[model samples]
Target: MPPIVLTIPEAVTASKMSRTAIYNALKDGTLCARKSGRRTLIPTGELQRYIDALPPYTGKV
Candidate 1:
């Protein structure tokens, strides 16, 4: 089974987003994260929700 939580780097890889983008999202409340000790973890479902909430592609650009 896939992991339920992903670290910052793992989230970047799985979402194909830059580390800065992920951090920005977290900072801006666009994405949610959890704390495990000193590590920040993103839930797979939360990431999926964030992606789903994005506007659909219109193929205009």
Candidate 2:
């Protein structure tokens, strides 16, 4: 079974995004994160939703 939540590094891998991007999203409020003591977790569903909501590729250079 897949994980219910992912660490920041896992989120970066799953989303194929840079760690900075993920942090930026969290800082900018585009992405939501949960606190587990000193750890930060992102729900898999939320990550998928964020990916799905991204603008479709137009093949522009």
Candidate 3:
């Protein structure tokens, strides 16, 4: 089966970011998205790439 594109709410849930943060990232070119008519969509692969590109987290000692 084919993967599904995510809507803003879906992306928020998947990325665990606030709506404002997602919009900011989109505005800053950190996250990629495409418009289909009036709906904004993020490809599953693109979201995965963004997550994969993030640096690893290290907790404070």
Best by TM-score: 2
Per-model root-mean-square deviation over C-alphas:
1.0, 0.9, 1.8
Better of 1 and 3 by TM-score: 1
lDDT values, one for every candidate: 0.95, 0.93, 0.88
Error of 1 at 15 (Å): 0.7
Off by over 4 Å in 3: none
Across 1-61, the per-residue lDDT of candidate 2 in tens digits comes to 9999999999999999999999998898888999999999999998888888888999998
Candidate 1, run of 10 with poorest lDDT: 52-61
1-61 per-residue lDDT for model 3 (tens digits)? 7557999999999889799988988898988999999999999888888888887888855
TM-score of each model, in listed order: 0.91, 0.92, 0.82
Query: So what's the TM-score on candidate 2?
Result: 0.92
* 2 or 3, greater by lDDT: 2
* Residues 1-61, model 1: lDDT tens digits: 9899999999999999999999999999999999999999999999999989989999997
The Cα error of candidate 2 at residue 31, in Å, is 0.8
Full ranking by lDDT:
1, 2, 3
lDDT of 1 at 36: 92
Ranked by TM-score, top first: 2, 1, 3
